[model samples]
Target: MMQNFILCLQEAALTFTLKKYLYPTDPSECFINPPCGCLNPGQEFQCEDCPYLEACLSSFKLK
Candidate 1:
């Protein structure tokens, strides 16, 4: 069970890194919501171009 948990964590971390790279931005002023296309329901919907991303990151962590 512990190993499974760790694997899940690794997958999540990898997914987040991919998201960060795909959405690369440091400010909310530059941000735009990612278009609702292939994304799964309840997934994040922000572009990396936002000027407020760093601030938003903290909140996102809680999720």
Candidate 2:
């Protein structure tokens, strides 16, 4: 029950972020991790580098 709720929230957040900033790309598109180092505009190379990790996870009830 809780897992389903969390999934719903995750989908929502990912959707919102995609809509707001990455509207040009399709959600099904998977981005490959850089072999050395690379960065997206206004985006950190990885989610681990994001300061909003805790907030985003908690908001989605992710473990």
Candidate 3:
């Protein structure tokens, strides 16, 4: 139950960030200032399944 709750929160955060922050502004669509070197912006990037979801959320440093 607890794991499900945490995953739900992760999904919520990723969805919000993608819709409100990354997609609207960045020309590449996403991967703005990615947390790690391996991540790259692309048309097929799926934030929902990414292991770096939390890092990307924090990297936004949203006010």
Q: Rate the local accuracy (lDDT) of all candidates.
A: 0.52, 0.48, 0.56
Q: Write the per-residue lDDT of candidate 2 for residues 1-63, one digit (tens) a residue.
A: 999999999999999878766422332222233222334513654644544443433444433
Candidate 1 overall lDDT versus native: 0.52
TM-score, per-candidate, Cα-based = 0.34, 0.34, 0.33
The predicted structure with the larger lDDT, 1 or 2, is 1
Candidate 3 residue runs with Cα over 4 Å from true position = 21-63
Q: Residues 1-63, candidate 3: write the lDDT tens digits.
A: 999999999999889878764432433333555444335444344544565644444455673
The TM-score of predicted model 2 comes to 0.34
User: Which residue pairs clash in candidate 3?
Assistant: none
Give the candidate order by descending lDDT. 3, 1, 2
Superposition TM-score, candidate 3 onto the true structure: 0.33
1 against 3, candidate with superior lDDT: 3
Q: What TM-score does structure 1 among the candidates reach?
A: 0.34
lDDT of 1 at 56: 51
